[model samples]
Target chain A: MTGQSTGQSTRQSTWYSTWYSTWHSAWKEQPLSFKLSSIIVVLVLCFGVINPFISYDPVLDVELSRRDLAPSWEYWMGTDGQGRSVALRLFKGIEAFFFPGLIAGLFAAFVGGVLGALCGYFGGWIGRSLSAVLELIDTLPRMVFLVLICTIFPPSILLISIISSVLFIPSIATIIRRKVEALGAEDYILAHVAHGFHPLKIISYHILWLQCRALLTRQMIFVFSYVLFIETALSYLGDYGVQEPYPSWGNMVAQSRISAVAWPWALPALAIIITIAALLAFGDGIARREEEVKR
Target chain B: MSEQTLVDVQDLVIEFDTPKGRVRVVDGVSFSVSPGEVLGILGESGSGKTMSTQAILGLIGGYPGVMGGQINLNDQGVTYELLKDLPSFISERRGQPEKNERAWRKHRYAQMKKLWGRAITSIFQNPRRSLDPLMTVGQQVKESIQARESHKDALERLNDQAQTEEALEWLAKVQMVDPARVYHSYPHELSGGMCQRAMIAVALACKPSILVADEPTTGLDATVRAQIVHLLQDLIKAEQCAMLYITHDIREMLYLADRVIVMRHGKVLEQVSANDLKEHALERHEYTQVLLDAAGMIGAHDE
Candidate 1:
């Protein structure tokens, strides 16, 4: 009974302490970039939440009568060439961009981490061949290669994300390889081996799991930023991005051109810039925190 | 208990292949360890004490090249070769070292994991870096205890409770007064001496026949070192386990070892019983004589 009570109290204390520290470290005394990035992310999340209820179309619902309008209370971010609410379009664009970026980020990290673990842990012919393939992909111009693949098949958010994830895999894999190699040499890992833990278990649970938690989160954000860049570039070119009627930041900015007295593409362009910057700053914050802990 | 050989390692040879030639790191080293025996294998840093111990664990091949000989262990009336049937290096991959290492590791991992902790365990040199920083002391000890068994329901109720109970018993055995706190704390929360004691508890958790302690007290300060050494000595007697105490501190072996084997450059130069060690006449080899002279025990004669 005494043992149980002691266990409970210790458990509670550890739990409370962990929660308190994470918040204090991540929020309080953080740099300006970290605060600004967090605010941007929260704003984006707010838009994503309210986006589904908003009824606004930038493509087909073209009120030619109200072609160019400035910012107003009725039309908060004004109307575009197609009489679409820019504020409404901004929310939808954020939703479209963030969703695919998130998917691509996860896919890239998973593939990269697994491939890199295999290479570092199980080396030899398998590692060598996979490394060669990664080198082959590394030299190709990302935009041109993505365009080529998209053109060959019907391009959408799914196809573009798949291509971008594949492109990001090698770089992420390289990072994971270096991490795994260094970690594999650590004595604690060898201790696991001495304790009769399986090599696969050692690789997955002990070596990789503990080390890669924060690292993978940071890497995914970086990958998310990359995916965001690719999506916007493809959208601007009017190819391989989300089609018209669906307001992707890329297409909303792409299918419309900038003009004096009416900047149709301005809001989406600015949204793209802010979202990418937010991702980078957030990732950098996490990375910096990791470094501090190491010291 | 009557004297019975728990470990009989025969003519062990460990070699690494370089472009120049096949270099033998540990050549034809052999020793037998009986139960309740504290046999010190004293040598310098590069004298292959640790590498030779790896051969006993079927881990020498984990690096590269060839390892030949038998590491026989007698467990429950069944005698088995710990280093037998391990794949030999093929000449086909003479040019490619990576393929050679990959092939060796696959086999070495399988063979080593079977005999690890259950049959033979080790306490490493650096105690702080040896414990996993993420896991609590209790969790690590529990894993070592559970490793002795084949398999149990990991998610079953009270499984953790039972493991913790058993782990705390080990902590208590290692003379840890506050077992409860030590069990709950992480590696970083403990001092270096405390961590080393925890590591000993971890090693003794399984109650294996042979414990290889490779310079286990190297990093501890003077007072803590004496305490830890005394703790280990008492535990070895109480557990009746054989210990291959590998260390470079030649003078300290007298306190811990019953019989000492002096090694130099991967070869056993002299093996002396503790009684004969005091006589100094048994240390015939020039290096052993030189070491004893350096320790100021044996005077050099102007022959």
Candidate 2:
């Protein structure tokens, strides 16, 4: 009995090893940028989820006695000018911008996908008028427009995200519209039209779902990364973003200007750069795969 | 035979504004098809054989398309007038077709939507490309089936099993070797002939009154083309549906079409019965004679 149990365990171990090796080899075959971006995104999400439980109270509570402390066991990124844990604030900062970025990205994807599909599929006066309106919106100075809106309305994460998403809509819609137009001219699409399928059905099921899904996802990630950059820039400008005592990356970076130590500003700035770069790389990787599939 | 005309197209005119200026692709083309009849439009490339059918199907678009036409459909117990009030929507200025582009599109498209699929369906030239690559043959056939079938019961749709059974039946009717396998396979997995068969199955699944086949055999090999043509002939006969068979090949046209209309330079040259052509009973036009000579039918007839 003992010998039989040992033999069965050996067989199971071999099966497990074989499955793992196959999975590992498949992962290795992916593009370098895809792997890197995926890893960063996963790590960021993990940190974001565990942040509230792991981060100390230094994010909000001021401890003047521990001011400008160097990196230590208790303080991972060391303390800032106000004796707040920079590491804890950075984790909180991820939460601050991430949710809002997601909201804005989803908004752009849904609204822009529908509008673009309509404009591209029906290219008569509807296409003409829609293109005209989008082009008019495109001509506006985005930063200036954003700043004006921020000033007029009370600055909040949701409002900022929504405003930036509106500015990004025209561009996203333009890309999708071009894709739909090119696809609409294909013989298969015309055949679908001839087969008497409704225009909405064709656009959604065939055009958007089957053909343009990757492009839409890539565009969504692009909007997410863009929102992150905009948020960081606004926060860095002080007065307009999350105020002091709130643990946003921009406000933390704002606290670093007078501090003699460099870790506080450098750490958050680095986080900002790495997050945006990873998101962009992930989107571009998807785009490259899409093009390869097309070829 | 005094059968009711299923489709009557009269004085159809279609134009396009090219860089060179306005070109009338279909000029005063008139034809009609009765149930269980095959009306073949025989022409070489750029001869407007396809355009006239496109107009009848309401598939014509672009600037100034179908400028003047009257297509009347008598099918499914509904006598509908296609291209009604078309002239009211269009005006000619210095030979350029002009109108309120927005209103015309809105009105004409809404009018055309009612006739598509159930009243009139079409099989496009390239079969592989025409079938949605992403959808299985069964799914596409099921979709076309569901388009009109659900309307029969007035809200209660066919269950999945029933739809699948119907789709497989259609695949078998189109002469698919293995209906079950073909049902599960996507268009890309099938051969060119098989793809065309699937396309036929999709088009016929709705049981349309009229089927417009545009160069259905253009891309197939000799044997496959012959097989497809035979299959189409048998299916049309069995279903008793009117077909608008468009082809440049004279022999195929003569073999399949009951009545043949030979066209060139966007004008109809001759309209004669296929039996009359075979028997040399009528004095054909010079262009029709040229086509006959090209097809080597005259030599065969003399022998």
Candidate 3:
């Protein structure tokens, strides 16, 4: 009995070692852009999660006497026209950027993935009607619709996220549906059906989880960047988004319009550019890796 | 033909809608297979040899699928018609093939779900594409075997070591060189012959009474093709299962099949014994003679 137990332990160890080596090698083979973008994304996510709890000097504590103060030892960056610390407000804006996009991305991916799989797998009247509704959403003017929603409801991260998720679902669902339609014709699907596997299991696990994982990940990441852009754009328009004294990135940019020099706007603008670029690059990297695996 | 008939298909007619009009793919083709028997369906491309088997397997779908047919299976002594309710869901119309597609599909799925992979299983032509690419060979084979157990037991047996051992045994039974390595390997990693072997292992793991091999050796190389044919022959004899072997190669069919059914243009020309055809003792159709000639057997017999 002891000898048998020893043999089993050795077998398990060998299996673990082999799996670890393969995963390590795969990570090493990733492209430079993917690695860089991954590091930046992880850092941004860490800051987003941990930054809110750490209290700093208040950005809303206005001081008219210290308005337009230049960069000095007291302020790392500088004071804005409203006499608020630019760096503190930038730190607070991280939550606004990260949380809404995350919510919207998750909502869209889950809903769209299910809808697309159904439409693509069983294409009949159900597919036709669902596709018709999606197309109607697609034809509507996006900017005009967003503006209308913002005006009707008080603009907040939760409300904006929900609206963006609804808007993003049709596109994601359409993509998933097209992919399902193409893969449905393959022989593997027919073989699985003949094998007596449940159609729902095959569609969800085999088709979605195994086959279309990379495509779905890329789409989800792209949605994050889109939400970030929309939030900042609305905040910058002045009347809507986050409101005064809230220190959102968009309102911060609006505050910079008073000064002649571009330094006040530089920090927020750089934050938006860097975050969106990193997201796009990360998505592109995933797509490139998927192609390589296929080859 | 002393053993009981496992599956009996009679007067199966399949049609598809085209841009021009409706075209019949399998026009009233019929055959049956008994336990421990090999029935070869010999035909050229587009001869509907595959279509007839697909119809029996209930894998047909889309517009005008299996328009008129009777596919009956004596599943463990309980016989039932596979296409009994198809007519009720179909409606005849002028200049068009109108079908209540959703209802037909629902009915067909309900009828076939219990029998597929349990009573009947099939090995398709392209083995590489037929096997799921993401799953390991062992996992897929294990899934087939696990489907035999009760649902509650299957859930508890999800990580059971016995199924893994059983799957490895199946791999060895199919004559794989190294069962352990091949068990963990993905479908894309193996050669064509190895993939076909894995596919056969998966099909037989369920312990079904009937196996449908649709041109299993078509895309393989010459040596691999011969080896696969030999492996299939040995498995059929050992398992004592009924098989419907579909192929266009007259020579291989003659060597492997007990009886031959020659088909052309969606019709069966003749059904002859393989031994009689080999000795040129039985009367054969012109198409069968043409196939024999192409296989270079006629000249050899004459010489």
Candidate 4:
């Protein structure tokens, strides 16, 4: 009888967990538009990765005779001033431009989220100190600071990415800090403490889960947009991703601008604009889903 | 009269430090709870009943309260001199007072954490705020079980997993309907009586030797109030667990308490057995008469 009862409980627990997981999934499932955009982004990223190794030669084929050739099968995205295939070059630029921004944003979000959660939960002097530091960082012009850091350092893709991440951290931290502060005041946390749950357990299992879910989802969209903007800005400025062997949407547009009457810059420029637009659309969908789940 | 004293309080005083000045809440109160006995503490609002309990739980930190007294729990083999120069000093001598102050304080706190649900548990007045809104009723009970059973061996641990079943059983003990469905529901989903029943299940999860129920039925409806009282009476008799039922209701004191202690303005006005209270209603004391009159008022209100 005892064994049967135990088995029954086990089944009940399994059913409970499965039901909870399904409910949670329903709450968090990405919207159709966001999912579609995400698919496009992934496909684009994959194409960027595979292009150089497959059909396109992004470097080493100087078409001096055919410089600034406009749209044809031989040069699908036309050729830039250096005779590099604008399409293939743009694909190569993905590694230097987009990836760095992605990494920087993610790193910043992670650090900010964790720090904010700790500060909010613990409060008192620790929270105050973190807030002070975050405020000081927030006071600076982050984009200018990123430019200054890149200028001071021997600008590698890694250094630029790190600089971008540093720029992003304080704002994300402040957002997460506010979220944590709100969650800390919840009755569940007090209940956990009253029941003698350890401080670490209360912070980790109760407070972090409560605050991080919505903030992290919101941060993902922010990071995606911010990274794209930073990468494009860097490329436009000619501080990075400008040399002949390197291909970037910003540099291609820059090159196209110089010889606009001779060559059409629309295709590559359109691709850049389209990719950013798609990302923004995707982020909006995600934001909507997050809002719905929060409700 | 001492089979084993679970809690002993002598001249317990609690003062809160406000911006204006020091305000004494619980002044010179003395009481004791023995094993397997119910001690009903009856008091008016702001009479220091809640504050005194909070002091016992060591939750009144930095509230500007000076608690001066000795509280000894014989079952835990610990005595606490509540009011000392430092907060650390009081906590140090809490449970098992013989260990070095610093080490004993750490040990006592740790021990309290371990013993909370198993040896001593509490039921709050507001069941809504007392439970986690995010968690299912079952999970909260499971959490209490996990806390108390942290040190149990494997077979005993299996029994601990049976806590949910035990909790469900306790639901029936509390006269709750459809325990299984109620267990799966959230706090807000349940009615006030059901929520209180779930709280009782959580309190009894670890089979505590002493249960501190802080106004268990104050906010409940009249019908639900009687049911809750009856449920508590049944559980108390069945489990033989000592209970400290804190309430302002004098009738509830007479109905549920083996012995009752009445308080006014943080001072104990009267303490008497339920039988003595009924038999000597007019002659015992003026405070006793006041309590009886209060009970009569509640009876009239019920009518």
Q: How many residue pairs clash in all the candidates, one count each?
A: 0, 0, 0, 1
DockQ winner between 1 and 4, please give it: 1
lDDT of 4 by residue, B1-303 (tens): 154788778788777657886677999998988888899998778988977776665544444353467665544555443343334444433342221234333444654565456666778888886776656787787777776666578666746557767656655566666666666777888888888888887777767778888898989999999988888888888888899999988778789999988788899887888777766666556766776685674234334
Listed in order, each prediction's TM-score against the native is: 0.87, 0.86, 0.91, 0.76
Computed on alpha carbons, the lDDT of every model, listed in order, comes to 0.75, 0.80, 0.80, 0.68
Candidate 2 chain B lowest-lDDT run of ten: B146-155
Worst 10 residues of 4 chain A by lDDT: A1-10
Give the per-residue lDDT digits (tens) of candidate 3, residues B88-144: 877878856577878888888888888888788899999998888767788788777
**Quick one: how many clashes does candidate 4 have?**
1
Candidates sorted by DockQ, best first: 3, 1, 4, 2
User: How does model 3 fare in lDDT?
Assistant: 0.80
Model 1 lDDT per residue over B1-303, tens place: 112777887777777767897677787888888878999998888888888886676555344544566778766456776666644544445464322566566666666665787778888899988898866787788777767654335454346566667777777777775777887787888899999999999888777778889899998998888888899999988888889998877656878899888887888787888657766543467887667777776753322
Report the error of model 4 at residue A260, Å: 2.9
Candidate with top DockQ is 3
Interface RMSD of each: 4.1, 14.8, 5.6, 4.8
- Candidate 2 lDDT (Cα, whole model)? 0.80
Off by over 4 Å in 3: A1-27, A56-76, A82-84, A259-261, B1-3, B95-98, B150-159
lDDT of 2 by residue, A216-268 (tens): 87788888887778777887775577766777777677778878766668888
Please identify which of the two predictions, 1 or 2, would achieve the higher TM-score against the true structure: 1
**Model 2 lDDT per residue over B215-234, tens place:** 99999998999999999999
DockQ of candidate model 3: 0.38
Kindly report the docking quality category of candidate 1: acceptable
